[model samples]
Target: MARIQLNNIQKRWGAIWGVRDVNLDIADEEFVVFLGPSGCGKTTTMRMIAGLEEPSEGEIVMDSEVMNEIDARDRDVAMVFQGYALYPNMTIYENIRFPLRMRGVPKEQHDTLIKRAAGLVELTDYLDRKPSALSGGQRQRAALARAIVRQPHVFLMDEPLSNLDAKLRQHMRVQIKHIQRELKITTVYVTHDQIEAMTLADRIVIMDKGAIQQIGTPDEIYNDPANTFVANFIGAPPMNLIAGVMEQGTFTAPGVRVDGLPAKHDGKVTLGVRPEDCTVTADGGHLSGSVYGVEPTGDMTYLTIKVGDKLIEVKAHRDYRADLNSDASVGFDPKRIYIFDTASGQRLR
Candidate 1:
């Protein structure tokens, strides 16, 4: 049972702060993802937990013991990196058995452990082949098998699927999820891909500029974001944010007006609405604009509309058709609208 806790963790390099004041409690066997863009300190925080880098402040705890001063090898954590760090000279069987050999596990049990780990990743048939002989996906699977052979208390995976192509990445995502569930190990996955975080994590930690933006389940993060940054970052096309003024619960912009909003302090505010929440309507619509572009993705269509200077995307059925430069009216549920402070970018209740 591995329960990991990061308490007010901070990492600094001279005057630069890589990670700041991060506090999180990860339950035993829980899968948590550290998600953000590059240079946001997600990887730094994971490094601290793995003992690859020491925290400038606060504590790293596992179960009930402090691990800040412990060496990485003694932490019993296995890491899978974005690069498939397999030994090109060694066969897959030897690569998977390396951890067992390093840990000095009994020679009699090495064969069983190696085969079990390889089988979990479907690499049993490729055990005799060297890393150079396998494809990119197969090589990554070997790396995973190496980590699994340890059966450690925690798994630290840093963008393990980022190197794969889209389809392989999707395939590996499913495989990784299944393998984690079978192992039941406490896992900390770091990635900049929102789709991976949304699909695989039990909870996601969104971070930016060396600090956490929000921590919640995918549903909560997607349905109820904490700020404009989160609203803009998590979605595919991202949420449409229109700069406007709110007076007496009515929001008005250059080409948009939405009423029936929560009656709070009214002033300059940014209104946010997701593309999927918007639909093309002929009458009683919230906003109207000229169609800028239409994109079809086999299963659905994305229509881009120009509202004054801002462009808004609306998700439509695959069979939906629209003409470019044509006038269009789009409607959205007022209850689903998100309001934020213009100055601070914080959510307005």
Candidate 2:
């Protein structure tokens, strides 16, 4: 049972800081994801936890023991990277058995452990094939089987599925989820993909500029964002934000007037509304504009409307279609609107 805790974590190089003031607690068997764009310090935090990189300031505790001075080999953590990292000369069976051999497990048990691990990942038939003979997906499964063979207390996976194509990625995502649930080990996964984070994590820790932006369940993160950054980051076509003025709970801008907001302040603000929350209207809605672009994404169509100088996307029915530059209108419930301070980017609760 590994319950990991990080306190006041910080990492720096000379004067440039890579991570800053990160504090998180991972319950035993909890699957947490560190999600962000590139250069956001997600990978750095994971490395520090793995004992690959030491934090300049902080304490890492695993199962009530301090790990700052401990060697990575003693951490009882398994890591699966984006690359296969398999030995070309070794068969998949030998590759999966490498960890057990290095850990000094009895030679009599190697066959049983290797077979169980390979079977879990559906790589049982490919055990005799070398890494070079396997496809990319098969190679990744070999890496996963290697990690699983260790039966470690924690698993650290960094972008493990990013190397696969879309279809393979989707398949691997399902397999990973099933494996994690079956093993029930404390797992920390790092990825820049929101879909992966949303689908896999029990909770998500979103980071930006070397700092944590927010930590919550996927439902909370998607429906209730903390600020403008989170509002724009989590969705496929993120929330639409229009710069305007908010006075007496009414937001007004050129070609947009969304009234009955919840804010009491009066100043420059940004109005945010999700595309799915909007509906196409024959009557001139609170917001109307010309169709700037139309894109059909199989199940639904996305309409880009030019509201004055700002472009906002609205989710329409799959059958909806209109000529470019045609007049269109969109309406949303007042309760669904999100208000943020334009200058500070903070939500106006």
TM-score of every candidate relative to the true structure: 0.98, 0.97
Give per-residue lDDT, candidate 1, residue 341.
96
- Evaluated against the true structure, the overall lDDT of model 2 is 0.92
lDDT of 1 by residue, 1-349 (tens): 5999999999999999999999999999999999999999999999999999999999999999999999998889999988988988899999998889889899999999999999899989999999999999999999999998979999999999999999999999999999999999999999999999999999999999999999999999999999999999999899999989999999999878888887784999999999999988985688889999999999999999998989999998898888899999999977789999989999989
Please identify model 2 stretches exceeding 4 Å from their true place: none
**Per-residue lDDT of 95-144 in model 2, one digit per residue for the tens?**
99998998999999999999999999999999999999999999999999
**Prediction 1 TM-score vs. true:** 0.98
On lDDT, the leading prediction is 1
How much lDDT does each candidate structure score?
0.93, 0.92
